[model samples]
Target: MLPTEKDAGSASMSQVSTSTERANQADVAYGRLKQLILDGTLPAGAQMLEQEAATRLEMSRTPVREAMVRLRQEGMVEIRPRHGMRVLPISASDMAEIYAVLTALEGTAAELVAQRGITPRQLAQLRGAVADMQTALERSDLKAWAAADEQFHLHLVRLSGNSRLIQMVGQLWDQAHRARMLTLQLRPTPSNSVKEHADLVDAIAAGDGPRARKVHEDHRRRAGTMLVDLLDRLGLNQL
Candidate 1:
């Protein structure tokens, strides 16, 4: 016998609920995978297996595929027909270009914030991130330190209140996440780096635009130089 109209409607509603639940699961999977990539758990040049990731994330293959597609769109993963997805390693070339772009973008953000001068609340946000980094360093929590470092820079950009700047810088930041982790691991972070953050904060607090720009520019370029030197030493001259 054919199903009644109410039964058909109930079946359709169930399908819709299942579809929505799967989409939510995919979002969760994507967020978790992205964090793993950023914090170095899924180190650069790693291979991502759909089955394995789905198992690890406790999600179905459909949601895992959804996550993988999003990552590919962001240039974080490459989908090979037979070989599966490979997490692209940040090459020397990638590092050089990323740093150059970030320096210019972040410098502009700093200048904007400084020119307008930050409110006390903004100052507190910046200081809070810097302080978290200092604490992470003292505790030898490299992962936490790296996270705080990103937050400090992002907070700086957000302070500018320019949505476009925030979006642009954020995308670049994500692309360079692996390189930044490698840099943090291979190089000895100078004590002055923390001091430098304080300097930038002070410049913004004082509404000194040029000083803010110069400080941020110098810091980013210095970091880029260090990472490139490391890559050269490791014979990875083209990334």
Candidate 2:
């Protein structure tokens, strides 16, 4: 079930307090809505009633609408004439495009990390993220695992220290996150993911850009292919 806007708003408020809190509120709304859609809480083709969302989030229609706009831009939601907003169906072609962009960005990060020599501190952070993911996986906590996975990649991008690359990758990361959640939910093989992540980390730590890039590319391609196959089996491909 999607969280009520009130619940989301209250949670946000508890975490952030300031005059500039509106921006934070909007971000929270956007992330929560996006996660709901990705996790199938707001299943594909489900109408996004603004009033209901506002009521649930404990926020006004304005912020909910703003969130919808962002989701629309991310290809996770669509607005129809007289029909209201609907969660967009995931498509294989869209998945392909997203993975393509992600591959490029990750490859660039790998090269940069090797060229610049990632700091030991940054590597420690990366290792710590992997440990968190492992713990999440061991406990069968899909959400925590997913969050940790994202943090790991985002940390790598930050290590690259390229503002433009980080910004572009951030967008791609958001799209990829939704797809990843879907994939993990369908398959739920925590052990495999842990091993793959560990191997990638090892390559990165060794400063082997080519190896690291190859491992990352292979992992993504395999995961994407698995997700497409799962969607096909579930008859979600028609979407």
- On lDDT, the candidate that comes out on top is 1
Superposition error at 10 for model 1 (Å): 9.0
All models, RMSD in angstroms: 3.4, 9.5
Give the CA lDDT, 0 to 100, for residue 18 in model 2.
Answer: 53
Off by over 4 Å in 2: 1-25, 81-84, 135-144, 188-192
lDDT of 1 by residue, 57-84 (tens): 9888888888888888878888776565
Per-residue lDDT for 98 in model 1? 87
Evaluated against the true structure, the overall lDDT of model 2 is 0.77
Instruction: Name model 1 segments beyond 4 Å from true.
Output: 1-20, 134-144, 236-239
To one decimal, what is the Cα RMSD in angstroms of model 1 from the true structure? 3.4
Task: Report how far residue 68 has shifted in candidate 2, in Å.
Answer: 1.9
Estimated TM-score per prediction?
A: 0.81, 0.74
